[model samples]
Target: MRSASAADFNATRFIARLRSRGLTWVLAIAVVLLQYPLWLGEGGWLRVREGAQKIDIQLALNQRLEVRNASLLAEINDLKQGRDAIEERARNDLGMVAPDEWFVRVVPAQSVQSGKTNE
Candidate 1:
C-alpha cells in the first residue's frame, strides 16, 4: 500500500511540474494555430507554387497567342495593301487560276507487286 501511495505521489508531482511551465500546452497551441495556415491557407507555399505554375502556363499561352495574332495581323495588313499578297492567298487557299492557266491534278498510282517484279 505504501508503494502504491508513493507511485500516486510521483504521478501527482509530475503533473504539477507539467502544469508549472505550461510549455507543452504552449507548444500544442502553437502547432494547432499554425497548422491550418501552413498547409491549407491560400497564401501558403503550396498555393504560391500552384499559382506560379498557373501564371507560367497562362504566360506561355499568351505568348503563343501573341505570336499567332501578330502573324494574322501581318497577313491581314498584307492582304489589305498588297495585290500580290491577295493573289497569293487566293491562289493557295481558293485554288484559283488565271484565264490562260490550266489546272491539272496528277496523282501517283499505287501498285502492289511482290518480290522483284518490275514494269
Candidate 2:
C-alpha cells in the first residue's frame, strides 16, 4: 500500500510538470500567431515597401513630366515673343516655302535586273 501511494505521488508530479510545459508551448504558439500579422499581413512591411516603390516611380515620372512641361512652356514663350521662331517652325513642320521659292526632292534610283527595275 505504501508503494502504491508513492506511485500516485510520482504520477501527480509528472502530470503537473507536463501541464506547465504545455502551457508554455501554448503561450509560445499564441505569441507567434499574434506576431504573424505584424510582419506579413496587409498593410505590413511588404505592403509599405511596395507603396514606397510606387511612390518613387511616380515621383520620377513627375520629375520627367515637369521637365517636359518646362520645355513646352519655354517653347510657348518663344512662340509668343518671337516671329522668327514661329516662322522657323512653320517652314520646318508645315513645309512652307517662301514666295518664289521652289521645292525639290531627290530619290535614289532602283536597280535594274533582267531588264526590269527592282522597286
Candidate 3:
C-alpha cells in the first residue's frame, strides 16, 4: 500500500470535516449570496453598463440638438439683422410683391410637371 503524504492527509481531513459540518453547502450559499449584489443588484456592473449606454444616447441626442439650435440661431440672427433675409422669406413664403412689380400668376389647366406637356 502507498503511504499517504502530509498534503494528501490534510486534504482528506479537510474534506471529512466539511462533509461532517455541512460547511460545503453553507460556503456555497454564502458565495452565491455575496455574488448577488455584484451581478444583479442596482449598483452592480450590469446596472453601471446600462447607465453608461443611456448616458451615451443622451449625449448624442444633446449634440444633435445643439447643432440644430445653432442653425436656428443663425437663421434668427439673419432675419433680425438683414433686410435681404426678410425680403426673401416674404417673397417666397408669402408671395409679397413690390409696389412697382406686376404679379402675374398664370393658372395651368394641365399640370405640366407630371409627364403632361401642354403643347
Please give the clash total of every predicted structure, in order. Answer: 0, 0, 0
Name the runs in model 3 displaced over 4 angstroms: 1-21, 102-119
Worst 10 residues of 2 by lDDT: 110-119
Candidate 1 per-residue C-alpha lDDT over 1-119 given as tens digits, one digit per residue, 9 for 90 to 100: 57988999999999999887698889899999898887779788789889999999999999999999999999999988979998898898898998999998654444333333233
Candidate 1: give its CA RMSD in angstroms: 6.1
What RMSD does each model have against the real structure? 6.1, 4.4, 6.9
Whose TM-score is higher: candidate 1's or candidate 3's? 1
Top-scoring candidate (TM-score) = 2
TM-score of each: 0.72, 0.76, 0.67
| Position 69, candidate 3: lDDT | 100
Flag clash pairs in model 3.
none
Off by over 4 Å in 2: 106-119
Assess candidate 1 and give its lDDT.
0.86
Cα lDDT listed for each candidate = 0.86, 0.89, 0.90
* Best candidate (score: lDDT): 3
Model 2 residue 100 distance off true place after TM-score fit, in angstroms: 4.5
